[model samples]
Target: MLKSQRLIRMIMIINARKSFTVQEMADEFGLSTRTVTRDLLELSELGVPIYSIQGRGGGYRLLQERLLPPIAFTESEAVAMFIACRSLRHLSALPFDEGAESALHKFYHYLPEDSKTRIDRLKDKVAIWSPHRQVLPDCLRTLMQSIMVRSVVAIEYRSTHGVELRNIQPVGLYESDGYWYCPAYCFLREDYRVFRADRILAASLNESIDCREDVEQRTLWDLPQERAPLIPMSLELSPGGVHALRSDQWFGESIRVRDDGGGTVTVDIPSDKIPFYSDMIWRLGEDARIVAPEEAVEYVRRKIEAMRLRYS
Candidate 1:
């Protein structure tokens, strides 16, 4: 094999093995030990994080933060990746904020001059805008780690009720509307609950509580199945309301456009979500009206009456 191909293959092997002697690599590559040693020295200089072990049972091993093998990407693929990373700039917090920023910088720095110019232009034109929420979820990484390891965590969380401590086995983490949500099996509730990450003041491994194996198997996609009973609801929307609702991720799919540009949203919403839908529709003012489900309409009515009394 060409030296370049051999080097790339060796990097992949090192990453997979993590700890292997020079003789092992030499045997695998059918190269002399001296040649493998020299190649290892070259890889070390190229920032592979390789180190030698002097004692018995210790061969060469990569550091904890080992370098990844190189992969080729077409210009278009590179540009697409660049755009995907750029779109996350609006998020206030990320699980790997520093790593994302560093990777973006490094990737952008190496792009061809013309690609850089194209990206510079696109930076002004394209954006995946998310609402700028000020609250940062300090426990995002902890929640992510808990999900990966299927561990129970004790969290100090502030909810609408008040601050409280709970032990939870995290199912997964997801971001929607610029906020992170952790769906977990709460020990206090003895059921699954979605906790806002920003409201989590602190999170640490709960060694006393055993992680639920069933919770670990649950995913964000499984949430809808676990929701409260679905109740049929309908909304009448003006053209402007239809336009606005078309951009809503959760509600957009339920909208059925009319011939006159107006639309109706027909959805089977969970009973517990009635107040949330009511508040959202109420904010649309005259543009939206509840067509069915007296519960949601009454909620809006009470809100309006409460506001009117406050103003009076």
Candidate 2:
């Protein structure tokens, strides 16, 4: 169990590293080939970097920015990237605007025959994404350029609350669930921070800012804790509560689903939003309960009183 978990983490964490074949990995790790393959599929569902390649010339390669020149995308890959980009256009800085006319022109020029066929198929099946629409065009372009160049950037940004102006040095550009983000160093806070691209009022390439040695590995797969103090606890959730965990649309990553039936969820969060998380549990009422870290029960009590006062 520990070995498979380790393999999953290895494959998931290094987005750029190539993966061993099932036989190679299994033999090296002393596991059955089936188990190794299973772990790979599981990693894929969590949006890990693992992907399969075909042909006698192909095996598996995890994509990293610096190694590959402008890449040729298969139809599925291109459409997947476009879909992600479309979503990111809303939430983060986009280095390219609708005017990716040039990039799109370049992108189309490199398509393999198979990828061209796939693009046509995807055109027949259109998809849409919803994100905060305020993000600007050039912001995205800078993000793309930064990701490709591994360059540092300076951004004058406003917070989600629209109350703060922060100057930050971006480390990497990222697209998470259709939103574009940069996890970077904040000169003001002197801490690592995540900034939505859409919120940046202005940006420029800042040759002065460099990668910080203090940066830590973070899971875009799992959101980092909030900067503000929060009450952390675990809770059991109901069927409907589990359904809410499907996307960050309502509740977020803290309320995670477990088991296949959408019957159990685990949450760790702040008392500030007690009503938000706990009331979600209370609404599920009998279906959810505080399971660990006793402080959660009081948070829930506060939520109940707020609900009572509101109803009264």
Candidate 3:
């Protein structure tokens, strides 16, 4: 292939993966529609998963599989991935720019005719993932390192009132918004559970820890959904509270969530596992109200009454 033809291939692989049309490519390349179409076909023939769509909110996408593990991304695709990865910088503060460059090198290795300067310029202009100044504890990072290695994490966490040692076996590390969380099986509670990264007073990898590295840790999340006694209860949620109520890595799947009003939403939940619900209500304060599963309603009522007494 000529330099221009190779550059065209690079452009299709990187830039046209999403939201680009063959017609648009033809116009940009100063080629006939059939020529652009043939180029896309050639890309597919060379083990690319580029597929097109027609409709509102639809465009092209390149499917990734084990067979086609590495391929160059266009300037925009590189920028987009960089932006997305930048968002995770808070999980650990490190130089991801360098890491991304190494990743791009492997991806773009086959495209000798590609414009490196253009790709770098596009990366410089790209922005997406926002970084925060929050500091993560070294212990917390160590625990996460263990989870990445599929090793057990032992924790000494302080409870809500900040006065208790809860020991747990970490199953996974997950992040939501700006906070990191460790989902694990609590040996003290004798049940599967979720623990916040901020609350973990101590965390370490124990060499003696014995657990199945083979069992998909997602089962820990499923435990919450499959608790023998279902609450079958519902409640109205506040809009502000709605966003935070999304399932964390350990929170499991949401059965349902419906907006009832500017200040309300309805949901069903288990009473025993009401910590997630109660925590959200506490976060929302007066904005939300419980409606059904009399037990849940009563639990909310007692919690409110206790708050009243404490203030009184």
Candidate 4:
């Protein structure tokens, strides 16, 4: 085989074996040990992270951070990846913030000049907008680590009520409306709850609490199934309200438009979500009228009255 082909194949083999003697590479490639040693030296110079072991029973092994084999990507595929990373630039914080930035920089730096020009032109035309929220969740990495190991974490959460400490087994995390949410099995509530990541003041492993075996298989997608009993709710929407809510991720699908350009949102949501839905509908003012579910109506009325009294 050509030297370049041999070197690439050797890199793959070394990555898989992780620890091997020079003789192993020579035997695998049917080459002389001298040639294999020279190739290994060349690989090391190319940042392959190869290190020799001087003692008995020790062989050359890659460092903990092994180099990845080169990958070939089509122009379209490369552009897609660049755009995907570009889209995430709006978020205030990311679990892999530094890694993402570095990767994007490296990827862009090596692209052909023409491709770079194309990307620059498209930057003005294409965008995936996410709301720019200022709140940063410093504990995002800790929370992510807990999810990976399925471990219980004790967290100091600052909610509207007050700061409270709770032990939780995180299911998964999701981003919506410019905020990160961690859905977890809360030991305090003994139920599944969604906590805003920004509200998490601190998080650390809690060895005192055992993670629930039942929730080990749970994920963010399974949250709807884990909800309390659903309660039917309906809203009558004017034309303006229909237009305003058409973009709502949560309620957009529930709206049914009429010939008059008006619409109605009718859906069953868990009772625990009533307060959130009420606040959303209340913000629509006259454009939206709550049609059913006296609970939500009452909540909105109480809010309106409270605001009135506060202003008075």
Candidate 5:
């Protein structure tokens, strides 16, 4: 077990009883007596209110009414939490940055002595690197605040088309590929839409109307539909196509890997993306046979012929 996790369990073990011998704790956690003694000492340093008896029959126990609420966890849970906190610590912007830091500190400080040592060693081993790191959106905090109060917010947003003012009911925020997006009820469009946080030039909450009561809770899929209808599509990839799928991560979530190295990838692509996928397959210069919606197959063939004639 990870020392950090063991430390948490140790607290629970000791708190469950009036007193425990080093042998008892060692037996429970599968650690050596010396290790248990070191853990108790570290717990003492952290103000766990432990008292130790001396000489024969000596053991450690917590003070009366000093028992904290039990927090039980499996080894995997502890490691997962540790890794998650480690990743979040590197994020430039988080809605709960301070809370995340405090929680991480508590997680580390209560770790078993060996686990602490392991974490120190692992710190250099693990890292979160963003190749195209974005400057955290300045409006993120304000947008979060607005969402909590269910207030309408006005934002000066810049998109590929142009800059415009948007009055939206702040709903929620999510991170995708390291960028944050806010799903909001766009007042201008009279529907829900997702806005990129980084594109929000400015934002301010509107206190006049409470739009929360009327806005139904909806998942990402429930968001307003796009102009292009979704269509069933499937593809048969060659070795290179499989490599492209793995490396490029294009339409990855829709892919299902098969046992024989090749996989079945079927998804409902937006009608507009059919042409895009055709162009992508042609660019791969690999043998990927289209297997569906005869339209896509014909589209790709024409593009290939066009390229062939251009080269010829």
Candidate 6:
């Protein structure tokens, strides 16, 4: 069994009886005596009321009236929660201003002393670099409320074309590139569309019923996570370009290193983001080359030609 599951089971066993011996727990869980002792120490550090007694039949027992709900977490899960809480703690717009603070307080107190110390060390090492953002959008909370009830809402949206009112049924909300986006079913367009949260000038609940039957079942995947019609791409990067790819915390996940020295890597670039890739490659100035997807090659040639003409 997983260690976390075993810890929980151990707690149940201890709580069921007035006392448990180290040998008995080791036999029950197929663990060594040292492992069982370590488990008890970890539990105690998490504020469990375990106490020891010395005698012929001596073992460990819980302090009277000090029982707590069994709780166990793997190291990865605890770290993930800490990272997420750290990311959201600064956002002022999320509902319940004090909720994140309160939760972090509880989570920090429950963490083992060692884990707490490790998290504190990580605070200095890990960083999420993004553009500054407001605490919340003008209508984020209201739009979220409408999404919760599957209610239609009338929104005054400022699109690039012009300002217009739209009646929409919100399906989901997401943040990307330092902006919030709401994917909703637009009554006027009679199709699903993504609306910038900041671009929403105003919003009000509408009496119109939400006609989207699968609103609740919709997922973020319903929107594009990557460029549509994903294309196979290959590229050769100079040593400098390779360093750029490896240094990007997000891009490094998708890159396959060609050698131990990190001299080259193969990655697929979204077709819709080719223009962006072209710009980055240009910055590399001969250090990056698109090796496949003839279309990307042609696109880059056209961009270079346009640049030359403009400069001429």
lDDT of each: 0.84, 0.61, 0.58, 0.85, 0.74, 0.74
Query: Who wins the TM-score comparison?
Result: 1
Work out the TM-score per prediction: 0.88, 0.47, 0.51, 0.82, 0.58, 0.51
Candidate 2 structure, TM-score to reference: 0.47
* Worst ten in a row by lDDT for model 3: 247-256
lDDT of 6 by residue, 5-53 (tens): 8888887788887688999999999899999999999989976788998
**Model 1 regions more than 4 Å off:** 32-38, 135-137, 224-227, 309-312
The true-versus-predicted C-alpha distance at residue 54 of model 6, in Å, is: 55
Off by over 4 Å in 5: 1-76, 90-92, 127-131, 232-260, 272-312
lDDT of 1 by residue, 26-57 (tens): 99999999999999999999778989999877
Q: Count the backbone clashes (under 3 Å) in each candidate.
A: 0, 14, 4, 0, 1, 1
Number of backbone clashes in candidate 2: 14
Report the lDDT tens digits of candidate 5 across residue range 185-244.
888888777788888888888777567555636545566566689887787776666766
- Candidate 4, 304: how far from true, in Å? 3.4
- In candidate 3, stretches whose alpha carbon ends up further than 4 angstroms from where it belongs are 1-71, 89-135, 160-168, 187-190, 213-228, 237-265, 285-287, 293-312
* Best-matching candidate per lDDT: 4
Model 6 score (lDDT): 0.74
Error of 4 at 56 (Å): 4.7
Local accuracy of candidate 4 as per-residue lDDT tens digits, 46-122: 77888999998766998876677778777899889988888888888776537677777878888899989988888
* Model 6: colliding residue pairs: 93-135
After aligning candidate 6 to the native by TM-score, how far in Å is the CA of 268 from where it should be?
A: 11
Q: Which regions of candidate 4 deviate over 4 angstroms? A: 18-23, 31-67, 134-138, 206-213, 224-227, 283-287, 306-312
lDDT minimum window of 10 residues, candidate 2: 63-72
Alpha carbon lDDT of residue 292, candidate 1?
A: 73
Model 5, TM vs. native: 0.58
